[model samples]
Target: MGSNLYDKVHIRHLKKLGDLVPDVHKAHQGFAEAVMKDGVLSVKEKELIAVAVAHSTECPFCIDSHTKGAKKAGASLEELAEAVYVTASIEAGGAFAHSANMHNALDEAADDALYRRSSMEHMKKLRQHAPEPFDAMMRFFQTATAEGKLSVKLKELIAVAVAHTTECPYCIDIHSKAARKAGASDAELAEAILVTAYLRSGGAWAHMALMIQAYGEE
Candidate 1:
């Protein structure tokens, strides 16, 4: 599946929403607007993380675009390389560190909860300042659902998995209930999540393969 995520552009966290659907530019914008408030991590660091994620997930568009974005956010070529190297290091590190069937399960679960809550808070804050992000959000939703051939349920599940992984509890609760009510069962929902997880892991494997081949040069 990671082999299929062929994005070549890199966007900030907000840009991820836009990248997923591409029609509702504001869906991307709203998300970006909300998350920008945190100001905890430097913009460069955030963009760097996004780029690393794109690399892991095989989002070529994200990788290319975020490489540009990262530069704009103060990431140097060396820094970007280092960041991806970190991604590589962590991934390569994982290849040998296989431990539990549920790798970092407790931490992952807690991360999910945190993501849901935090995203909700961010959205809430964004709306308070912007005052009309909903209309744009709706438009983004409609375009993605109608044009992308993405099911409403699939969208909800996508939201759920991303929210969970990103630790946005508000989004998790909202999307999870929506997904289940829309007919995604426990198994279906879990499958969606595992799909997300597998893709993440498999993405690293792709990089590992690359590194293995490169190092084989000698």
Candidate 2:
């Protein structure tokens, strides 16, 4: 198939990945299966996390695949939408959260410590800089994360997982606290983290197809 950088994914290349590394492919499949199994969280919940992490990786393949998985696992479109937005918020939050570093760097007299809770205050500057969009995002985040079909606790748990994958300390702090307040146990939190681990790894596994195209068969 003739394709360029912006073309929709040509899935034929994906099948070739199985041929490229049969063992690794098989193991990855098995790991994905095992990871999604019901444990502290249900498979429906796991699929939601998959969808969320897929957004973080910016992998269209994983996003579509796991959105279907979430639907099949009994997730409503509303629930799926919430999960995707949780991802959006966390990924967006990563950039917003890391702005603390920018704030610190700007202060010539600031301490060597780049990330301080106090620096989060600098986010208020957005209200002055981009009032409309910043306020809109905050409102959207509140709506996306509020109690709904998935429950605040469950949403917070998913947020925690996405935050970890994105490595946003502010998001991690905010959502972990929310998760705990919503009665998420340490065990449940751990399971969510594991789901994030699998989904993050699954992204690389899914992209082996691109590698197969790059390294054509012998």
Candidate 3:
């Protein structure tokens, strides 16, 4: 009704529908609480994962909410910043990783194959031409995923979650190995992925409140 349509106040509209769908509303709330509680990963760790996945989802509501949650859960500003860059690296990495597809497409004798590990060799050309930016990205990714306040193991785990969300096989392959190398057990990686699943689903669930407001207005 004003200059902008999506203000924080719009979230309250979900309560107006509570009586109509009490069970569904309550289930969503319960699931959110259950997933966010400390498990194998602490709440602080979970919130950081949420922040990373939130960036991949590009859900402003999620980014805002989880950044606040991460801070409240005792994630420092540096930790939060590092988490965001991890997300960025994976997101951009998705694009770079998929360049293998283009390589396959360009080769006259490339066969019908759409993907192969050998296709990644095409990336070497970037080192020849776009050396500066390519090297800079590599530096940033290394720095971001390196151990600081957050361990390399944790950051690699977060990268795995984002790789799943992005559906990038290259990133998954690279980070999974990196995660394991950094001492992330299979169980810890599994738990991080479950947290990712929660945040991905939760992004859609959180936006339903906005959908309700929009529909009511129409």
Candidate 4:
């Protein structure tokens, strides 16, 4: 944010955005380093890909930054425009793909109305102060995830790294507990953290080769 781009009006608009936007300021350092080091693509393509990924992430700040980056990296206006469109399309597709998950959870939630009523009855006296409806909502999720259709263990492990990468504390807490419940070893969790760190570090160096190749052309 101390950089020049954040000075621009468009970017300022994004920084002032509400809670829905992912924290780009936190993500930028890792993002800048990650792809350049580990990505096999050119800077131009990488920026464009970042542009598309920004859309999927629903981060307006990221979108603005990557759109600028793509243009600077030699992506044409049309290319950047099309990348946004493609991003939207893929996100819309994901909505459909994820609907089954929603339906599965919803059905499970409703399937045990008697159980829900009983739980509420039990809760009225247990703790004068109790957790809100969130736990009740999560019961449906626990039930649905327990079914063999979704491997809760594997999914929890995957979700933890993704949550940390995305900087969601709630997600990190929830998924880490889930991973432990699923019997994931502390070593595996530590390994996952290292993997994210490695990816973040490698991204920057990977692009240094571009500077080398450019110099070689002389």
State TM-scores per candidate.
0.42, 0.86, 0.91, 0.36
Report how far residue 74 has shifted in candidate 1, in Å. Answer: 43
Candidate 2 lDDT, 1-218, residue by residue in tens: 34563234655677765776799878877887878899989999989988988888888778878999998999999888888888888887788777778777887899987667788888777678888988897897888889887899988998999999988888898899999999999989988998888888877766766675556634
Q: Which candidate do you rate higher for TM-score, 1 or 3?
A: 3
Candidate 3 residue pairs in clash (backbone atoms < 3 Å) = none
Candidate 3, position 43, lDDT:
90
Clashing residue pairs in candidate 2 are none
Model 4 pairs in collision: 33-203, 33-204, 34-203, 36-203, 36-207, 37-202, 37-203, 37-204, 37-206
| Candidate models: Cα lDDT each | 0.48, 0.83, 0.85, 0.48
When summed lDDT is taken over every stretch of 10 residues in candidate 4, the lowest stretch is 117-126
Mark the 10 consecutive residues where model 1 has the least summed lDDT.
93-102
Best by lDDT: 3
Model 4's TM-score against the true structure: 0.36
Worst 10 residues of 3 by lDDT: 1-10
RMSD (CA, Å), each prediction: 18.8, 2.7, 1.8, 16.0
The lDDT, on a scale of 0 to 1, for candidate 1 is 0.48
- Highest-TM-score candidate: 3
Give the C-alpha miss distance for residue 147 in model 4, angstroms: 39
lDDT, candidate 1, residue 118?
A: 38
